[model samples]
Target: MQLKGIHHVSSLTADARRNVDFYTNVLGMRLVKKTVNQDDTSVYHLFYGDERGNPGTEVTFFEIPMAASNKRGTNSITKVSLRVPGDSALEYWKQRFEEHSVQHGDIQKQAGRLVLPFEDPEGHRMQFVSDEHDQGVEPGTPWEHSNASPANGATGLGPVRLTVKTAEPTAAVLKDIMGFSEIQSYPHPNDTDLPDIRVFETGKGGSGAEIHIETRSDLPAERQGRGAVHHVAFRVEDADELQQWIERIKNARLPNSGFVERYYFQSLYFREPNGILFELATDGPGFEGDEPFEHLGESLALPPFLEPSRSEIEARLKPID
Candidate 1:
């Protein structure tokens, strides 16, 4: 069955503040909420995205203040990419990056679209595309939060982009069983200079849109570790559709790890041959479960299992402010 689009991309990092600054300052994502990790309240859970912190457009992080240096493993995504409105958005980002003094990779076209690649302060690689389409959200910059209006900031979860270590089985599963059709292909969108990169866009290409899988076959496979993507989640209409996908994954004999609860949603994790962690997640009982939409990401939220320990949990969390 075909899935909607990426639900969210979650990763681990050693330093929380640096991660926050890089995403907000360099990338222009709004730090919607600052809270503690639900699984480990001692750590921090940072959510960054378009204004109002909508789903689909979110890039989430679990901060391990003292995490060891990461190895870019095959299973973990090396870069998290975002698709902007088009080439015109580049000038805005160019000035923003220069303002922050963040080191950046030259503009290169990948997956049939122009993309500006840059790295977070903690060395997490990220890119934004110039697709010239409705990105469906606005993004806020840390340097100009007070200046951001309701209209200019990212509105919700948009597309989550990814790069794969290989294209064989991963691309195969997506095409064969996952029902993802390869829309089209072209030279890298950012530059006509580099070798062509295969771009796979899934879904209708809407907000919380599908990923653009790129490969630098010349580069080595990444090692999965902290500051690296844990998994790229795709969304379903609800739990029922998710169960259907579980059966589909089983039917295909793909290596699936059954289901795991993420408090707000249930998930099934698996790996496509190329080594990227893939997750099937439900959209129900979403970010609004623990708190009102207006108050989300503003506090530490625990699942039912941890509800009884709220007091202890709250005591262990560091103040976000």
Candidate 2:
């Protein structure tokens, strides 16, 4: 069974509205789903993605006010990289970030591509990689709230960088279990402490097909909080393939959430040996499952089981915008 590519990267946010503004306005992604986190129901679970909120295109957040800042160290997702169409798009984003007063770094070459590094308002690490190698999504409907038009807008997610104390364990999970191939190694772009980063390729060996593992033997364990990535999900083809993975995970004796239904998609979650949480998610019954395509993210939506407590849940959450 092939783990397709990145389904979504979920993180924690301090303020839902601020997170929404940055992702929708500054980053030029569509707010595809607005719902409360099922586990808590007191906070918002916001989803941002491409025009249709396609599986690999999504980035979600759990609103957690008063949460501590992320402690960057080993066993954490250090950066979430989004794919932009080309060099022009990358330049447009660089200018857009500058005019908007968004903190960013110099556009530099990394892994044979141009990368523009930046952070969200809550300090969640983000980057835009120009996929000249044709590794990004093609332009479709334009993002309505921003000037980053379809031509230069973010296509979808690219590689996610995971920091770990040792690469072997995480490497094995990515390679053997997740259907990724150990591609190559590169010097850790920003960390002088890391000797080199291991790279893996899943689908086409570019953009969403990649995963970068940064080895830091000297770093401390990560403490998750706001701006920290809680988990990264990889997409599975459909229910049949998802079931296959459930069996594989169980047979391998890997600790995993046994085929949990997430409403939007069914998922199987497991932590890699180093502690980074990974999820295998199905692609169907997506963001449109509970809402129509046109009215997505317009109001709060709850999963079937939680509908009974909708009133109480709604009472607890502050309006996002």
Candidate 3:
């Protein structure tokens, strides 16, 4: 299977505006698109990433007002890392965190990259690292200096990194099925139980391996719950290869056997050994289906199946504003 890389990472949050504020304000990521969940219109489906909202850089969230406990174990989200410019940018982020009053762990290094770990408003473990990744999409830089008087600002989504249970079948899927070739490896640092951090890029050293996967800790496993990433999606070249990927998953003894087509592409969902859900998504019939890329997420989009309910669905949606 020749899968490209991540299409986007979807997770849960208690509120949309708070999540938006954290990404756009504190982190300096652009709200690429603002829209509502196709299925559950009541909740906003927010997209945050670089200028064009390219693959791998996009991290999505669902707003479920009822607060839930942050879950962390062997199968949950351990950490989410994004690659920024470098070590100097990290110092800027440190000052920014202090200014925003956002709590974060001390600066640290992992796999030869400088990382600054922090949590979102909802407790989602997220970090920004100073590693230069050339995402094919022209990356965006922050427009204004921070109010904290930092030398720099938090840049756009670097690379969305996820901690997996193990690097086995998931790693296999990445290399063999997904078409992500091994780039290199690095140690997880002294304090972490994580093993050597293996690197893989989407294609021909394609800019920031859209969906970069790494195991948080090799010691044991964890469980998924609130605040942890629910699933990550890898983009496929087209529908044919995507269909083939569905069979490949079953061949690997993965249990996802059905195809649920979203507006832009089709998807196959199955849980990896570590319990984090993995989504194989087709890259085409893109955001243009409802609106142009420049204007995407500006309004509600309906899947073909849900087109008939446009009025009723719009009516039922909660007032996110």
Candidate 4:
């Protein structure tokens, strides 16, 4: 069984409303789902994605006030890169970030593609990669209320970068279990002295299909905090395929979450030897399962099992604008 591409990248957020404002108003993604973390019903799980909440377009967050103050380091997802229409789109984003006073770096060439590095208010690293090769053709639908114009909106997610003490073990897991190919290598874009980063790809291999591993042998392990990524999920076809992955991981003696029904999708989680959390998720039974496409994220949603406690959960949660 092969993975399609990244399903979503889930990170930590301290404030639900601020997170909503930044992604929806600033970056121009739609709020696709308003739900709670299934495992811990106390925290809110917010999903941001393209118009229909497509798999590759999602970047979600778990709002946990207590764990909101963590640090970044090795053994973590250092950057969540998004694919924009072209160089002109990158220029548009550059102007937007400047106007909004968001922390960002000047446009530079990374792997022969234009990239603009930036961070969210909570310090989670993010970047926009230009689709210079015309690899991504998915038309991004800008949220009607967003500040960004529809013409220059972000298309979808691009190469995701993960930092680790070494890339061998993680690379092996990617190639063997995740159906990724060792594509090529490039010098660390930020630091010339560090080891060259190894790139991998899944599915048909373009744009959102890539994963870059930075072998930062010198840096210590990362600390989990507000800006830290909780896990990176890959897209599988459906529940049957997800079950196949569970069996594969079991046969390989890899530790994994057997089967988790998150209402929107079924998920199975596991960690590589280097400690980066990886999830195998199905693409069907999407965000529209509970709420209509036009009304998504407009109100809180609780899974069937949790519906009984909806009142209590609603009373406890702080309203997000």
Candidate 5:
């Protein structure tokens, strides 16, 4: 079965409250899920997305209060892209970022699309990509009640950029193992002197369903901490497809966490040859499974297994709002 598109990207943050404020109040994404990191119950795992926290729209964070600042380098998810309505929306966001004092670069064209690059308070690299001419997987609806107008609000995730020491091995895993098709290449936005960045896409490809790989022999392996992306997940249709993918990955002889029950979705985690973590996750049983849509993120939520220890988990997490 073909993968749909990006499921979500999970990153690190040191301060949960400030992180929530920036994503919800400034960026205007809805805090769709307020929960604890399943692997580490002591910390908060917050999810932000368009109105309903659709699969491809989510950007998540794990709170690590004492984590060091991320040291930028190769072998990392260097930048995350969020899709806005159109080129005009870029102008809207450029003005909004100014009003909110968000650090951003002037709108520029990258890989044939107009984009406005910006960073969150924690220095997480992100850009707002215009979907004026985008096709393929549909975008999610922006939250109506957020600070930004729904017309110009960020819709869903776009192409995720992976910076690696060398491109061949990582590209091989994407093309040969993961079924991504190499579509085209473009000059690296920051350095035209380096090798051109390669673009890859899967099912119903477009801005929403592509991966941009940047090969930089110049930088060292990344020192991941706060603001570093932990992993990027691609979307599979359902549990059955995920199970089939688990078998496929096993056949490919990659070491992986097979058949993980994430509650909201099933997942299989593995790393590409360059050591960048990749996850294949199902698209159903989403954020609304536990809480009513209107009240989502208003209270801390736990999966069925974690429900027994909710009291202890709640005691450990600092209030994010």
Candidate 6:
């Protein structure tokens, strides 16, 4: 059983209302699911994606009110990349970011593709990469009601960049356990003298299915906070495939949370050698399972297990809109 690609990246947010505003109104992604973290039902778990909240398209957040700012350093999921239509779309977003007063840098090339780096108000690192040359896992359709034009809207997740004190251990885990292939490397953006960032790809290898690992010995381990990524999950076909992955992780002797029922999808979570949390998640029974397509993210959603406590849960969360 091979992994598909990125399923979702869950990050932290202190302000659920502002987070929803930025991702939906600014980035133009659809707020596909308004849910609570299953493990801790006290906070919001917001999911933004393309039209349908497909496997490779989601970017989620867990609300942690008044959390401190993230301490930037190594051993972290440093940067997240979102895929836009093409080169011209990068230009479109550049202008849009300016109009919205979003902090961003000039468009540049990364791994031979055009990318425009930016940050949310809370300082979460992110970039928009042009999918002009992508050939692998297909991207999701942009939301029809997005504030940004569909042609220029973000489509799906691209390569996630991880910064660590050393890359070999993490690289080994990715290659040996996750069935990823080391395709190529590119010079680190900040220093050519440092180790080159390595690119790894999985099923259908493309922007949507790759991981970029950067070695950063000079920095300390990250102190996670409101702006830090919680974990990155890769795509599994279904419960059957996820079960196989659970066995694989167990066979490898890695500690993991096996077979989590997330309602929208099933998952297994484990940390790699570098301490970066990784998850293998099933793709189906998606966001549409609970809410109607048109009214997604309009109300709070909890898994069947949590439904009994919906009123209590709802009372704790502040309205995001």
What are the Cα lDDT values of the candidates? 0.64, 0.85, 0.65, 0.86, 0.93, 0.93
What would the TM-scores of all predictions be? 0.81, 0.95, 0.79, 0.96, 0.99, 0.99
Task: Report clash pairs, candidate 2.
Answer: none
* lDDT for 281 (candidate 1): 83
Better of 2 and 5 by lDDT: 5
TM-score of model 3 (CA atoms) = 0.79
The ten-residue window of minimal lDDT in model 6 covers 312-321
Tens-place lDDT digits, model 3, residues 196-286: 6667767534434444556655435544445767677777777788778777778878668468777666788987665567787776665
> What are the runs in model 2 whose C-alpha is more than 4 Å off?
135-147, 191-193
- lDDT for model 1, please: 0.64
Per-residue lDDT over 140-220 for candidate 1, one digit per residue giving the tens place of the 0 to 100 score: 222235233322333344344455556656668878888876665556545567445444555666434555555555556
RMSD (Cα, Å) for all candidates, in order, is: 3.9, 1.7, 4.0, 1.4, 0.7, 0.7
Clash counts per candidate, in order, are: 33, 0, 8, 2, 0, 0
Model 4 spans with C-alpha error above 4 angstroms: 136-140
Give the lDDT of residue 156 in candidate 2: 78
Better lDDT candidate (4, 5): 5
**What residue pairs are clashing in model 6?**
none
Please give the lDDT score for candidate 3: 0.65
Poorest lDDT segment (10 consecutive residues) of candidate 5: 312-321
lDDT of 2 by residue, 49-81 (tens): 888788778899999999998888899999999
- lDDT, candidate 3, at 312: 82
Task: Report the poorest 10 consecutive residues by lDDT, candidate 1.
Answer: 135-144
lDDT (Cα, 0-100) at 234 in candidate 2: 89
Clashes of 4: 2
